[model samples]
Target: MARRRPVRAPEPLRATSMWRVDQVFLTRRGVRVEVTCSMVNDQGGLRNLSVTAPTDDPVQAVRHAARFIAGRGNVSSARQARVRWAREQTTTLQDELIRDRQLEDEFLDEFEETLSAVRDQQR
Candidate 1:
């Protein structure tokens, strides 16, 4: 058997992968949760990235996900909360509008009746 010399690996272009996470954020969507990462691209510009951890640890992923969750600002829990409030407001406003319409109709009906009564009295 001949002894082979070990070949050295080439230097990596960057210290970390472009998808590497500088921070993480945990986001909840309804009962489910997802992880997001904050990373600098090749250009070194700040960006929110959707990615996965090498070990697939939710806790570690959440740490990077925190960056995505906060920076991306699309958390489902908060969105659902806002949506619930909006729906409630819409329902209340709709009810009020219907009530106002009913009141207006009654007022018009009464006004016509009063005018008719005045005409009868004149006769």
Candidate 2:
């Protein structure tokens, strides 16, 4: 019997200079924002990555997506990268809301309204 070699993961793109944010917009899916970003893949081909931020704040969502693409980190695969990126963006947004009193108040007001609507539907 011949022994098989284990498959190694593809190396991450080291030069992120080609990466850029294409668009950032709010999705219709209540309080969700979608960020579309593009970059030159390792194969010298153009690739687009779209990630979502589960927040009502469009400004903060855009910033979070831009930072994720600009940050130096390993991106093994699109699925893995997106999951990691979205989690980081959510955490950063939460931290920002905690630090900004006005932003926090606004977010809370919107959240309470959403909750109230849901409760009305259930009752």
Candidate 3:
């Protein structure tokens, strides 16, 4: 009889002051990337910020999500620098998509709708 090794339990999610990539998966439209920012408040309560980005590439999606969250404030200078880097990368990707004519009208409509919804929610 062969002995089986015990399975280790999955690690718990750690809260961080900066946004961290939580999950990435494919969707019918494109790849979806989810990020989370968690921190403990002065009142000992937990605060969390989460956002998802739908894009062709997971890396670009993550950068987009990070840039979005970083705009919300309370981020460190180092994190802000990282966000700037992400913004540049995202811009390059967008240019490439435009140059390649890879962006579909349907995708643009959906993206505009999502962007409007986010803006509405912010207000």
Whole-model lDDT values for every prediction: 0.38, 0.45, 0.41
Per-residue lDDT of model 1, residues 1-123, tens digit only: 999999999856765433323433434444444444444544566755454434344344343433333333222111111101112223466643332233223323433454455556659
| Candidate 2 residue lDDT tens string, 74-100 | 222221122112333544656433333
Best by the lDDT measure: 2
Q: Report the lDDT tens digits of candidate 3 across residue range 14-33.
A: 56443332222222233554
TM-score of each candidate? 0.26, 0.36, 0.32
TM-score of 3: 0.32
- On a 0 to 100 scale, what is the lDDT of residue 18 in model 2? 37
Clashing pairs in 3: none
* Candidate with the larger TM-score of 2 and 3: 2
Instruction: Name the top TM-score candidate.
Output: 2
Model 2 Cα displacement at 121 (Å)? Answer: 49
Q: Of the pair 1 and 2, which is ahead by TM-score?
A: 2
Q: After superposition, which runs of candidate 3 have C-alpha atoms over 4 Å from their true positions?
A: 1-30, 41-45, 77-123
